[model samples]
Target: MSEKNERQLRIVGFLCNWCSYGGADTAGVCRFKQPPLLRIIRIPCTGRMDPLFVVKALAQGADGVLVSGCHPKDCHYAVGNFYARRRLELVKRFLPFVGLDPRRFHYTWVSASEGQRWQEVVTEFSAVIQELGPNPGIGADTPMETAGQAASAFA
Candidate 1:
């Protein structure tokens, strides 16, 4: 592979502890080979997800962000995933407004027992991110001091 192709993409994965994290663990136990690009963060529940977290990841140069939780109503905390779904959707939609591509962020549901499903989700998302290449970051073309000055002026 060429050096560019051999370079690993940086992907951040936010996984709910009750379901999605377990699902990823299960995939590992099953010896499924998956892309090594994802750096997983375990959250208590999807309800705990904050849109700013996704923004921060992208701003800090993550090539992509993936959020995985329980399957809707099947969330261990009952309504957690539902809230997550709504919040993540807004984040995805708003990304473009901030000069980031919506394709760099994704969300999905995976149950603890669905190891194979986790593998598939990771594989697919990883490929998409790899194709998108590294994220240029939020306002990367703008100088930080200039951007900060503009923000302060607005305030």
Candidate 2:
């Protein structure tokens, strides 16, 4: 593979233990093809994932972040996914304010049995990031001001 092709995106995924994580594990067991970029971090519930954790992952050089959990009304924690909805909405708004493309982050719901959906999400997310190319923050010392400008442009 060429260097560019070999340049792997570092993605930090926060998956709900009850659903999305299980779905991903099932995908593996079922031998469903998925992008290798994703590095999943399982959480008890989507509600348990703090926005700071997402920010920390970005700061640590992840090219993108994905947060997944049980579908609404399907959370093992009863209503935890609803809480995640509100939190992720705010996160979507704030990431743009911080000069990151809102596209760099994603949130979704997948049931434990949705291995096909899990594969689809990973493949699609990886393709999107590949098209966007490497994160400037990781490859270069992009000033916040510059990133802010880029964000404004994207906006």
Candidate 3:
């Protein structure tokens, strides 16, 4: 995290409304520190996620994206996680096709009360991203330019 060129990787996080989102909220209320790198976007269900959203986040300068939802048998929407799993499988392939580090994307499940788990996940994911270094493709076009400009160009 201290390297001069180690860009602070912007991360977009998609969390299921009922579980993962609440878990994140709980973490915050409990003061469980997690990396500020992530920007959380709550969705009605994991099934609501579109592959386009993932691509767009990456294109817009997010060095990584994380998707969290209810566990397999815990989804309030019953099958939302199932659909998400299937769709992300394709995203997994597409990341590599575009020369992105496939490790930039991560998926997990966090229940409403799992504040500790939520914190742990963020810690691990952020660590991995730090290890991978910054996403060169997103900022390669304009290293000295404003992040917004770079993101727009990538997008």
Among the numbered candidates, top TM-score falls to 1
Per-residue lDDT of 51-93 in model 2, one digit per residue for the tens?
Answer: 7677567657788899999999988989999988998888778
TM-score winner between candidates 1 and 3: 1
Model 1: lowest-lDDT 10 consecutive positions: 146-155
Better of 1 and 2 by TM-score: 1
Query: Which lDDT tens digits does candidate 3 get at residues 65-134?
Result: 9999999988898999999998888777766555567799999989999999999999999888877776
Q: List the residue pairs that clash in candidate 3.
A: none
Per-residue lDDT tens digits for candidate 1, residues 26-131, read: 9999999999999999999989887788878887878999999999779888899989998899888877666778899999999999999999999999989888
Model 2 weakest 10-residue run by lDDT: 146-155
Candidate 3 regions with alpha-carbon error over 4 angstroms: 1-6, 138-155
List of clashing residue pairs for candidate 2: none
Off by over 4 Å in 2: 1-6, 138-155
Residue 117's lDDT within candidate 2 is: 94
Q: Assess every candidate by TM-score.
A: 0.88, 0.84, 0.83
Best candidate per lDDT, number? 1
